[model samples]
Target: MEKKIRFVNGEQVQTIGVFAGSETLRGYRRDVATITTTGIDYAQAVALFTDGAKWSIVEVGEEQKEKVYDWSSHGVAGPITDNRDGTLIIKMGKNNTVEQDLQDKVDTARQETAQAQAVTEALAGQGVATVEAAQAMRMMIENAAALLPDSEAAAVPSLSKSWVVGEAVKPGDRRYYAPTGRLYKVREGQGHTTQADWTPDKTPAMWVVIDIAHAGTQDDPIPAAKGMEYEYGKYYSDPDDGKTYLCKRIGEADGGKIVLHYLPHDLIGQYFEEA
Candidate 1:
């Protein structure tokens, strides 16, 4: 069984459904309404949540009707199908692990369904033009985007072990290990990559060592020669394997606008600070 953290001092947000746009954009307005309230500072936030601990866990809803495009070939050449039932419950709170985060996947799916319904509803309305319909779709996409966290989410608290819950950063995922001062490689995405989720020791000490499975410049050919140290906000892909990874100069990815979905990896290392 995987481990998860339940926060001692955080708040949860009850949501409201507010959909913008007439005709086409009239679909799920409530999805955009879910809000969050957090009590922990940045480091603790990052240590516990994927969105730098924004704590927003989207529980997906039921399946709503979907318009068929050439690409929407029943889960073929289209966007990912997270949840289709049509109910969405998004929960943002201080969390413990990516697996823990998965517990709320249903909520996010619900949000998508609701928003999708809103779009279809708007499109079905009278006098809805193509542009208006497009706008409604954009609104739904925007709702998803709004879930992101802010900038300060990456900041590490000085002289303390900030509890952070992160997504699965594996041993093989493209990452930069600061402790080793060498970037390693994970050729296949998660398929070939073997990694354990990140967890800081409950008992703390002095300095922390963060180990990263990294990706270096493909142009360099050799990894050690091309292996480099990360300062902050540097994105790179492995040359031999064509895998991508990024170093959080600030030390993490927050639910904030700081998105590294483009970056994948499960990084683990240690440090000693406090108990």
Candidate 2:
């Protein structure tokens, strides 16, 4: 490789060697630099001082090359290369720079890998797949978070009360009535009914809430309980009519009973009212 001077930030700097030194086997020149540091591991690009020459170590190598600069960078010391194994063979450079440069590259790569793995793990936690997909999902989430107000963004909304009327009765589910202030521990989930006319008060066969309001209709027979957990901005499959609904608010039934207010999930932005 032919040795030429390099420039950095629009300033004229020395051009020590192209790929450094000289090789008789193959005279292929490359625009690269090497540096060696002892004990200290340099992970990123940084300024190095040696023999009144300030060099910016760009690449780090694990082997020896006297006349070959592995990579090139624009800096005060012109072009420099970093070698990791012991010392680097430069025309007139020290192994100190090489060590530091190699260490820096290794450390930087390790850190980047760690960060990528962390992101992947987080995405996996959310059931997202693939690195690219995870990244896209994360970007979307970040954008969404940025759009929300500080209080809203920072605060994670959660329902302290877990019981939902429509949810299938599970052994661990709690059966509670705010009006009566009664909490019942459902032993066997089977045959316990909590639906209207078939509520725990009536059937107690299955801990299921019967939707008496929409009973015997095409709507979902299951009734949602008061104070059931619901998430805003999420699509919920309404058992009624097998249609999807978007929960809008926690409202009340005819008797001021807690219920979820929802709209058709596929509804577009428009005005509508009762005739």
RMSD of each: 24.7, 22.1
TM-score of each: 0.14, 0.21
Give the best candidate by lDDT: 2
Residue 154, candidate 1: C-alpha displacement in angstroms = 37
> Where does the lowest 10-residue lDDT sum fall in candidate 1?
71-80
Q: Tens digits of per-residue lDDT for model 2 on 187-233? A: 45363434545444333334323222222222332222332333333
TM-score of 1: 0.14
- The alpha-carbon root-mean-square deviation between model 2 and the true structure, to one decimal in Å, is 22.1
The lDDT for every candidate, in the order shown, is 0.31, 0.37
Model 2 weakest 10-residue run by lDDT: 266-275
Candidate maximizing TM-score = 2
lDDT score, residue 91, model 1?
A: 29
